[model samples]
Target: MSKIYQLVLHALGIASFSYSFSILHSLSKGESFFFSIHVISFLKNWFMVIAVPLEGLISILYWGILIYDEKLLFDKPRLPILIDLGFHLIPAICLWTDFLFFTKEFRKSHSHIFYLLLFAFSYAVWIQFYFIKFGTWPYPLLSKLESQQRVGFYFACFALCTGIYHMGAFVHTIFNKSLPVPTKQKDKAL
Candidate 1:
């Protein structure tokens, strides 16, 4: 997919989610429907919620496919292979295609790294909250690991997100050399 297409998809996805939440907020309060900036800002963390998916995809591929025992995956609830692919593998493929193909227009600047980190940190907080509330780890890999190990896993996730952002920016700069940067210019002298 082209970078512009990916960016449009991401932006549309965010707007759609924000709209859905805003409608829910207004409806819950018996107010007329409107997209509110105050509400969106209040719920800003909900935007660009891609890092969690990235985390899941990365952790599963690294732990489940790369290092874990085969039987662990084969055994148990016996989820169909297609289901796993749908949830995990397919998104990774899409993310890669979005980053790798026709992406000269999508150069992530250094400031963008913070966006990835924000999501990663927010996700870690959410996971910690969920674990505390449920007394269960959401994933088998985390559940099996010790507390120290789990912290290491979270650290690795942060590192992975950071590396991805940096690498994306570097690739953008390198691959997009021939592409002209769009800039806003003043009107001609009147």
Candidate 2:
């Protein structure tokens, strides 16, 4: 049962990652210019949003089970959850803070942080290579910004991912701890 559950969760994760990457790629290509017309329309009309969030919820559920078993989730023998939480929380904070205060509003969700980090970092590196090769960054933010600013933007993205991850972990911990334990079965006289 656990294996089946893990398989399903992993499959969902992969699907979500792929869907998100397609959207990001589309944005980079200027295929979708307007924010609402792009993301909202895609999410509302397609399977990305629902599949991605559902995948994340399943992943979190698995993590919660692990944490419940040991009262910790990060390292073997139960390292502080905070350490793992930091991994997710930092990125999430950076991404949101940078965009919200500096750049345009980008929808930040805890569900997409892991995949976003993976996609963004790889995509950013690829964009850098493209810029080196053809003198053009794929995305507007990267194209318009100075090198230092772009690097900072990447770091901010990392922080945002970490923030969202930690938030999810913390919430899972709280919920897991608060759940009612099942009553023990009383053995009757044979």
User: RMSD of each candidate?
Assistant: 10.7, 19.8
Q: Which ten residues in a row have the lowest lDDT in candidate 2?
A: 97-106
Question: Which RMSD does model 2 reach against the true structure?
Answer: 19.8
> Which regions in candidate 2 have their CA more than 4 angstroms from the true location?
1-121, 175-178, 182-190
Residue-level lDDT of model 1, residues 110-185, one tens digit each, is 5455666676677678778878877865555666778888778787877766776566556556755776779999
- Return the TM-score for each candidate structure: 0.55, 0.35
Q: Write the residue-wise lDDT of candidate 2 on 1-190 in tens digits.
A: 2323333444445454535544453456454455544654444323332333333443454355565653322222533567535433333343333222332222445556655566558746865776787664443345557889888877665665465445544544444454577999999999
Give the number of the best model, judged by TM-score: 1
* Candidate whose lDDT is highest: 1
